[model samples]
Target: MTGSGARSVYIASAEGDTGKSTVALGVLELLAATGGRVGVFRPISRSEAGERDYILDLLLQFCSVDIPYEECIGVTYDEVHADPDAAIGEIVARYHAVAEHCDNVLVVGSDYTDVASPSELSYNARIAANLSSPIILVVKALDRDPAEVKAVADVLMADIKSSHASTVGIVANRCRPHRRTDVLDALRDTGVQAWALPEEPLLTAPTMAELREALDATLYSGDETLLDREALDVMVGGMTAEHILERLGESMVVIAPADRSDVLLALVNANSAAGFPQLAGIILNGGLRPHPMIDGLVRGLRPTLPILNCEHGTFETARIASHTRGRMATGSVRKIDAALTLMEQNVSQAELVGQLDLHAPEVMTPQMFEYQLLAQAKSDVQHIVLPEGGDDRILRATDRLLRRGVAKLTLLGNPDSVRRRASELGIDLADVDVIDPTESELIDEFADAYTELRKHKGMTRDRAVQVVRDESYFGTMMLHTGRVDGMVSGAVHTTAQTIRPAFEIIKTVPGVSTVSSVFFMCLADKVLAYGDCAVVPDPTAEELADIAISSAKTAEVFGIEPRVALLSYSTGGSGSGKDVEKVQQATELVRERADDLRVEGPIQYDAAVEPSVAATKMPDSDVAGRATVLIFPDLNTGNNTYKAVQRSAGAIAIGPVLQGLNKPMNDLSRGALVSDIVNTVAITAIQAQNLKNGK
Candidate 1:
């Protein structure tokens, strides 16, 4: 359990067919009932045909989770089998990607399949340990004796305990009704929480689709939707029609030769009878098709029953279908509801949820950070204006922003040109507000307001009118007069062009002197904040301290804990230079002015991030080697370093998100992608939210 307010648990089984999916579904339902956002993850899936994982798909369909299907699966079992070393890292990375946005995630481990290695248990343990997730192991106790089941449980418990993952509880699935009490008593002294789930035949019955796949059968006639109907058992129609009618059971798939028209007719009649059990479907073996008259008669029924033809003989098809386990289909409400109820009755929901440890230290991975940004932006809708609306990337991002309901957009451009470009891109702009700054009706009003604000610098209204003609200046005026909540530009313009208007109009926030910017450096594993990267080329010691404070505050807004690291060429007192002294002075000033902040001074790049270097360089400093916000000494170093890391390491750099502004005004790189624009727009919206709440 962590105090970070995010929680996750890993569910694993000792072997294949242990009813793990049932426990996973039950847990997901329990968590969702609390009204918190829940997510599901399959770290190692067995889906080889490029089809979606059945468990993952089922959970997404039934649960209230809002993420895409592909986002829930980490990697396939074959990928891990081919290269175990590299696959582990990919699994953890992908899990973090999906887990960041969820309040709680139920991680389903791999099913012990034949294609997987014998060391699968070890692999699952390693995965659980890496994720720091508590384990809820599910063990099968159907066929084995009570003592044998106890032995298996003991070994699994020992292995999990040795792996350093806390075993929260164990669910003994499919235990025989007669021996369930004995099995529970045998494992009572294992020193761990355990539940014995009795075998429920209905919960394990295969659906008609599973039978068809297992027998490689062809559907001769039936509605495709009825394929999901559960078959309680397989009955062979080897006797006369009258004899087969007497043996028919509820939800049974009758297996016989295709030429057995009498048996087929009798089964259909039995399904129609109110007193008899409903026939799930019929499978004709020996590669045989029914007579045309019989098929016509069956299809003539008001509600057609499923009929499948297979090439195998009756015994072979029956053998295959018997081995197939029932799986809950995506929309099978009856089966899904039954499975959830079964688990809810047997498993201890309160105990399992209590051990999830929701407060664990929340590590803000890149994916989680981006998801949080979008989620925060949507919480309170904000209107933002884009000055460079002529750019295709801006227009495309506008489409996505509006489609997702993240923010309301107003594009500042020539309306005709903007409409023409949008048409060429096949984007709809009906919901977006397009404004041509030169022809707008509010031009005079905006010009008058701008002239009043800048009248001390220049005493002419003509100059103000011309300045307002520029889109950047006009957009900034909209923010100044509260016409828009935020502004984002610079896609096809310079940073100065975008920020100059903001500086002249909105200025800096109160008690703040220097205006600075920070780029959210999204590395593969974590997200870091790089400050003073785009603005403030050179600054005095006082200006540097202000930038550090502002950068730290900016990081907090985006869910990052700020440990400010003042980067310099020298580490502590190791070297003497004018540049190094400036950083040292700035670090001291930040500490004295904001005593609550964790500040470290004159630290080298390696010392600021690498723990080993910090131990030798500055062991007593808290921010050394663990910095989340890096404050650069000058623009030359900050800009070059950010680009180098971004290009060399393939890191995603978001912004020059401007800080210390009275209102939110951000700048973008000239070669920004559509996704970059989308992210910047979302960031601006969130910043607007903060200002609206008076943060």
Candidate 2:
């Protein structure tokens, strides 16, 4: 669990059909439960279609695993078979690409589908060893002798050790209930940590989708939601309807001829009744369809049974269903739950998770930052107000945020206009609260509150009422009155228009001399905080120091270890000028006020980012080239530099996240994308959380 870089574990099997996916799922769940942003990779995938790997796709879809489906695969089996050497190179490269951004990665080894090559097992070992990942070997043990289990473990351990892949543990899957203890003992005697998983019939039975795939069947009528149902047993409807009905077991798939409306009707009626067994599906053999009258009757009943028509006869269809294995579909919650429950109950999750080295590195990637951001925002849901409700980007982001359940949103605009725009854009705002600032029932009360807060600034009741008509002031007042936890604006308004009300009403936090902002520069490899980018055009030395301190705190809040760098044209007094002297003075002020902070100042950008350049420029300073929070001397430099990096390096600049605020309020660019709006909203929600926790 403690490593210098991203830690990875590879799950491999010596032979095929070992149910390694179950182990992978359990591992993913354990890692996720422990607050790990876990990623998955399949080194050599067996899927021929241009689709995602089934197990990896399931994890991404259902487990809240923050990884792309394409990122989960390395290479296809055909590509590997064509050129093994090139395939290995590509696989290693892709695996590292995924592993670099994750705290922990679950590398799934190849499923030995191609038996033409006898070196498939060795190939898996080679891939695992090359990646420097620890291996967890899974072996099938159902109905096998203890001696055979031991032999498999011994051979696999030898091969893995020979290939220089460390074996952290071994799992004997599908072992019989009575033989589990003996098999586990045998595995442990081989000097490896071991666990035995009993054979689960529900896991092995074919699902509706798998049956359809195997028989190339067509679905005539059934609920689409029932397609994930598992066919636990197969029954042939060759006998009379009453006899067949008596023979039907729980979750049975009935295979009958197309003309046997009596059998089909009996099954359907039984399914609809209370005490009878529920059929998983009905396979109509011989390309059969019910009679016109029976079809109309079935349609009228609208039973929830999934009906499939196949060309094969009753016995052949039954045989095919029996041989076919169940597959985990994208939305199959039952099987996923079963897998997780099975592993959690059987496997030593604490020990297994502890064995994984998952220490994150000093630098954070964009994906990691986004994942952490979402997780942080969801930790405590907060209500956020968006003043630019008429903008498509804001509306779209509102929809996404609601869908993800990250925050509660209140859009400020004319209610009718907001609804019309949302409808035109095909966005759903049913859950969002849309308010008209002028027509609100609380206008007079809000005017009174605003007058009380701004009386010293020469505000009157009439003027306060007029000012409250503006959506920005109204939204900011909502924050001040604790109606909403935060506010995000500036998409369709100037920065002054968006932030002026906040500056007047919300004000700055206690002990904060200046209100500043920081942009989270999401570079390709790591995230850096660039401060004073969108606010504070000019500041004195003391104010600059405050910005540095505030930016460092922002970095810390977002999981970046802040090493402050007071950036300038000079490096440690190498040059003399007004700008350089001001930067040096600010650095000294930071040292005086925040002595505990690690800071270096009057450093050039090259020295602050390039280690080799720092070695020649300022070698003795800890933050010379490893600064995670960069404090610019002026707004001109900060804004231009952030933009340059954003355009040239393709970095995602995720702010001007305002700092030093009594309550959380953030601004966005006029050209902000929907994703940018979503991220900004999440950031504001997290800032609100900080205030709630009294951080």
In order, what is each prediction's RMSD in angstroms? 16.1, 10.7
Q: lDDT for each of the candidates?
A: 0.82, 0.83
Report the number of the highest-lDDT candidate.
Answer: 2
Point out where model 2 deviates above 4 Å.
Answer: 1-362, 415-431, 456-458, 619-622
Q: Taking the tens digit of each residue's C-alpha lDDT, what string does model 1 give over 455-478?
A: 889847887788898999999999
Distance from true location, Cα of 487 in model 1, Å: 0.2
TM-score of each: 0.54, 0.59
Off by over 4 Å in 1: 1-361
Instruction: State model 1's lDDT.
Output: 0.82
Model 2 lDDT per residue over 312-381, tens place: 9877888898899887656554555567656866898667866666654454456557756866897799
Least accurate 10 contiguous residues by lDDT in model 1 = 359-368
lDDT of 2 at 566: 93
Task: Report the error of model 1 at residue 46, Å.
Answer: 12
